[model samples]
Target chain A: MHELAVTREIVDVAAEKAEGARVRRVVIEIGRLTPVAPDCVRFYFEICAAGTAVEGAELEIREIAGNARCRACEASLELAGPVEGCGCGSFDLEILAGRELRLMELEVY
Target chain B: MCDHCGCSTEGHEHVHEHTHEHPHEHETSRTVRIEQDILARNNRQAEWNRGWLASRRLVALNLVGSPGSGKTTVLERTLKELDGQMNAAVIEGDQATDRDAARIRATGRPVVQIATGTGCHLDARMVKGALEKLDPQPDGLVFVENVGNLVCPALFDLGEQAKVLIASVTEGEDKPAKYPHMFAAVQVVLLNKIDLLPHVSFEMDAFLGFLRQVNPRVRVIAVSGATGAGMLEWYECIRASIH
Candidate 1:
């Protein structure tokens, strides 16, 4: 639902970066913990980027894997879905990385 | 549509009509290295709002939670208790209707309502626009009642000093565990509706247990807006934040 707003921001950023030039490709990074869906982003990108410099541009979404460590057992593992509790029967955990939401690079014409 | 040099085509592709002309090398095909956050605009706006509020010494608290987390109830109770002693204002963000704003106005406090027709969360731009129309006391509290959504609201920065989240006992004890982002983002959580503790099966220790796991620094206060339980402590928390 909020993907549209975030996509608008992405398109707007790409447009600003183009500075009136045409966009060819856009590279975006999303971590596993981030709730943004790559599919939804691509869908909204079509609408928000229409008739703009980013229109029809290739949207390359990079999904980063989430890494976390269980606080109870000190076990390191990949974080599961929102509802998935740790294997150690403890909700306590430390997120090491993979929460990035960034627009890394843009190819423009 | 190309923005610069005014050379746009239906598609990004330019078809050579008859002869193969040297591929025009305009600053067009260059890959710009921009390591920027996708939410740069919003983050920048949030920074602007932060500076604006700081200039006036205004303390803003962005209240966010599930739709029935007793956010408004908490605010209503707080305003009722702290009315005369503190001069506070509200910016209500409801999907539609000014009912929440009207409810806050009944307390005789200045309030502004921002109805996001389809938007799920309150962004920094909306708060900046609201600030332009109302005149809250300098160094006063600005409570931005974000649209009742734990997920989307957590992603937005409304330039508030803190995010006050409330979850009723009626909801699942694992509410924070389910919505880890919101729990981790907020500075405090008001475990509201404790008055019905007997009627509900919500485990206090379990709820606090999950909360501690997600946000060790976030303070958790038990309250019941309906019965005015823990209102004084909540007020004290607000006072400490402002001063």
Candidate 2:
């Protein structure tokens, strides 16, 4: 899965930042609809971090819900899963969130 | 002898043993929190590719859909129709083989194929390298046909001017609802194989309704590569977007 590739990048970034420092934790922000599995990323992170500065680092993932704004009704709604329109029967909608995959912060000493 | 604990000859021994390997093994585990975008590196490459394309005034379109959605067929037809009028190049991305690239080349257009081996989608870095190999000039059209997949390709942007989603009538109207992200990310929705509409049970109204629901502003064009039905409209849309 693409999670492997994503995990590799996370490890690279974390290892680069944690040079000469001991990594305590890694917090990642993942959107619900990003098509990336948290468990898969976590699983790959352990392998990717082997012998690196991030070895034995804890992976903390934050799942973000998908949010959208209806253009016709002007209503903002948060969706738990995939659905096209807003609750107001409006086809016009703009995605506000739940498409993110980012590393928010890291704790190292 | 230690004055603190009164252990007989143990303080020096303990201190010396601390630096050496012990007979008993202890397991140590630590936790670390790393918050970062998994696609950060890919996104950076995508941005750079976008800048490179923009500098050349090249309009790159990434065509994405499931296999047999007639993506290559649409391109073949488009190239044949736009012959001599537009300078078009194709970078065909498939899991294996250069068959699509060959098909595009048959139209006499410069084409390159990027076989992704086992990858389900084409990343931006692959596109960046393909662009260099193709060396398209400004005002030329660059069409990137992504690997035949509906899910993964929607997550990665290949530095294209627009992402076009191709869906045939045979795929059913529920495809838009089922794969919302792919439809939502696309600026143009090409409803291919309209010739089979009479044979298939595709509901035009429902399909359009669902497509609009997912992407309200996405322009929809119905065409059939087999029969050449409604192809002029599709060509005009491409022409308008490119120049």
Give the range of the ten consecutive residues with the poorest summed lDDT in model 2 chain A: A79-88
CA deviation > 4 Å runs, candidate 1: A67-96, B1-28
How far does residue A105 in candidate 1 sit from its true spot (Å)?
1.2
Give every prediction's interface RMSD.
3.1, 4.0
Q: Candidate 1: deviation at residue B90, Å?
A: 0.5
Each model's backbone clash number: 3, 20
Chain B TM-score by candidate, in order shown: 0.87, 0.85
> What is the docking quality class of candidate 2?
acceptable
Q: Quote the lDDT for B4 in model 2.
A: 58
**Candidate 2: tens digits of C-alpha lDDT, residues A14-109:** 877676776768888888767777889978989998988888888888899989887888999887766556777886767799888988777786
**Per-model TM-score versus the true fold:** 0.86, 0.86
